[model samples]
Target: MLEELYRQVQCPVLAQLEIGVTPCALVFLDAEASGSPNLRCGDAFSYVAQAVTLNRSLLNAGLPQLTIATNAIDLVDDYLSRLDAEIRPAVFPLRPSLDLAKETRFYGAHFKLDLLEQMALTLPANRLLLLLDTDVIAQHGLDPDLLRRCHASGVGAFDISDQEFSAYGSTRVIDDLELVAGRPLRNPRWFGGECLIVSAEFVGQLVPVARACFGRYRAVIPDLNHQGDEAFISAALNILSERGQAIIDIGAYRMVGRHWSGSTHRDLRWFRGCALLHLPGCKALLGRQANRRTFSSARLWRRLVLKHELNRLVWSLRLHVQSRRRDKAIADSPEAPSQTW
Candidate 1:
């Protein structure tokens, strides 16, 4: 299934890149060593396989460089041998001396450490770093020209949401920027953390500082309160702001299977612009509903068109079921009052 997804998307991406130009390299920071129970091993393997296929496709398409970075040296060795040396994977080890002390489980800190390890292996000032999560899969190849345009325009981020920014206190920095730009920087949106494109220059500027900050603060700070790399990024932005550095805000990109929590329908607007779709929980849902003939794409379209009515029906059914359960519970209760409210 992973290989199939790669074949579908990677072929087109490679065909589009210029022959002489240096191609972008996709990077992932494997966090398998952290032993976090929340970490899904299957998802990690699927992601790595997809990356391997992408690397192979890009090389076949004539891209100059394709690399993978991971702290799992043995895993990297096994993967390269399995691929028959088709994909060149890079091994990055965690600093042996760095103390990773924690009172309880710290997922965010683990992620920050992983990011730092990946960043350390990046070559200086030329290549584009395509950072992605283990659960995310590319649906379509990115537009090379569009990516270049974004870099040229100094766009730091794409698909950022205001809510996420507020959650991270990034809005405070944006408000400060508004004061400098002499305009309001309102209604900023948050971007998902699944994928990001970072230029070598930006990485050079931010990665070191983020590492230093994390290293300095990791031991003393409470695990629950620490915001990890994202918060560190927010801090880096703050530092840059103080130095009069400009931040370019690129608007949202199309992302499918993300808003599935709200509704199952795909947003056409997202499809038109998004290069990737994050199917975090869709695997189970799609599998379960696969046998239902009524849940086909055509029927899904019908559901979208009549969303309100369907939602109402679902809500009514839930309410009725809840009422019956409540009544039954009350009837069985020994201390139940006779008066019905």
Candidate 2:
């Protein structure tokens, strides 16, 4: 079923890109689950194909030569058969020593490890490597100047929602970042795991740390699951920053969207000229009803007004009901005191 969908979805995208075999790679880890009513293997395959299609289009438009790296076991070749001949897939085998018994809440850690390992092995010694998540679908073609800016930035990272940590029970992850970065880690207004760019030198530095951290934690915390790759990354930056390393140098252009709280801040006026806009969570935001979409504003006045009105209405209703209940309870009392008392 997905084969048909892949052909329908991917072929057109390839045609749209008009790309001859390029040097860029689009990497994805396998979907973890076996099967479900809402999402089957076929569905996963189709979704990945759609993502690749969008990525390929972006690459062809001007990003860079693309290559895809993923775990060998997870990526099915048959699904990729229809892609353009220029597109190549590099598969990395799962590490033999990785203990499967060590449970992790951080599913993204697996993908991050796979990406870092592949980058360490296959990435050119001094070229740029863009690491985009499988779920990210590029809506616009990247300009070459933007690619240059990312390369020049030394390291590029995106933000995720602060709310996700509590939702995922990952306060410990925040502590880890603070320890590594040294200073208190400021929670970005917007947080998510959508995209990252790594220079060859940065990859060399980060791969070892990521492996060590994953290995150590997997052994001790058998049940720590979380989804913030950026958190782990932020921790790494903290470590480098303490050592006086130029941890993350934002490039000439900011490569994320204005909708993100981190990007929306008035303090982020510096990023006004950024080239890439990480549009994580925009799809769901776009899907919401108009009333719900009003919450996307970063303005304090707007939010306070909306919140105040809502709270007033709810509290007024609650107080009225509570007063009536109290009066009735007194009337029902057998030896009621005087009303004034």
Candidate 3:
């Protein structure tokens, strides 16, 4: 299944670069090192949730062999130990040479985002990469055929709600975004990387662009509670899309399958192909105990959109209204005040 996804997602890059390699998913975990007191930031409970979800989500998706690079190696090991044999992940100490840890400056959240960009660079430039946030986990299993939309060549990003130009606290993010794209950033769907899929071919070029954007962001935003890496990533995607790269919006490809959840509610919704879940701003979840939770005890709140016409009509209307409201917010947004952490 992974090989199929690999072939589908990397095909475009391969055609361009004319390079080939074995097909396999190189899964990675990027999170704040809460176990290291010096690097810790945000609620420890949230990190706990991220780790716990990573383990269970991978297990549920039947994906194992996760490679981790973190300051909190021991803590990650503890969580992986809980997973059964086939699903247990392996931990790797972060390479010092790749140590882009910027905890000294950005808040823990920023540091994690920086780390995520770094991890994208460190993956071997010969295989497929599945870079997931600690907060995102598998809501259900994966079927490669069902993931066809996500499998198309180049870079694929999750569709997220809170991704407009105003999404970032630092106004610089928006400015940098426009600068990168060489035009006003315009997109109805905000590009999200929480569960990002990248072909090795683009990573080499992607890192520098992301790093430049990150540097510009850090130079401007002088505080903790700023938006994470998604904005910078959006900048990269905008650039790539302009360059004729196959940057697939996973949500649109899957049509009604994969949905983005920016709400913090415990309620879960599943579309036909909805596989992974991103827990972004749930007040009940974040800034608190990310304490490792049990996946076994949890049950799917909803699954496979009902085939009824009434239900489908209602869902379609709700989505249209939500999209309109979001677009209006971004379009009507006033000039943002500059921010300092």
RMSD of each: 11.8, 14.8, 9.8
**lDDT tens digits, residue span 88-154, model 2:** 2333444422343312343423455456555556655445566654433333354444445445545
- How much is the lDDT of residue 324 in candidate 2? 100
- Once model 2 is optimally superposed onto the true structure by TM-score, how far is the C-alpha of residue 96 displaced, in angstroms? 7.7
Sort by lDDT, top down from the best:
3, 2, 1
Candidate order by decreasing TM-score: 3, 2, 1
How does candidate 2 score on lDDT? Answer: 0.45
Task: Give the candidate number with the greatest lDDT.
Answer: 3
**Which segments of candidate 1 are over 4 A away from where they belong?**
1-47, 53-66, 84-98, 102-126, 144-146, 153-155, 163-192, 215-227, 250-272, 282-341
Q: For residues 7-86, could you state the per-residue lDDT of candidate 3 as single tens digits? A: 75876453344222211112233444323232245344345445544665566655544555555667756765655554
Per-residue lDDT tens digits of candidate 1, residues 1-341? 98857754766654344312222322333354233333354344444454544344344434443444444546655755755443543444433223454333433234543553455355454345555443333344555654654454333444444544534466453543333223343333333444555555665566555466455445434432333344344444445545565554433434222433233244444533444444343333322332342323334334433543455566567667978998999889999988767
Model 3 Cα RMSD, Å? 9.8
Q: How far off is residue 17 in model 2, in Å?
A: 27
Leading candidate by TM-score = 3
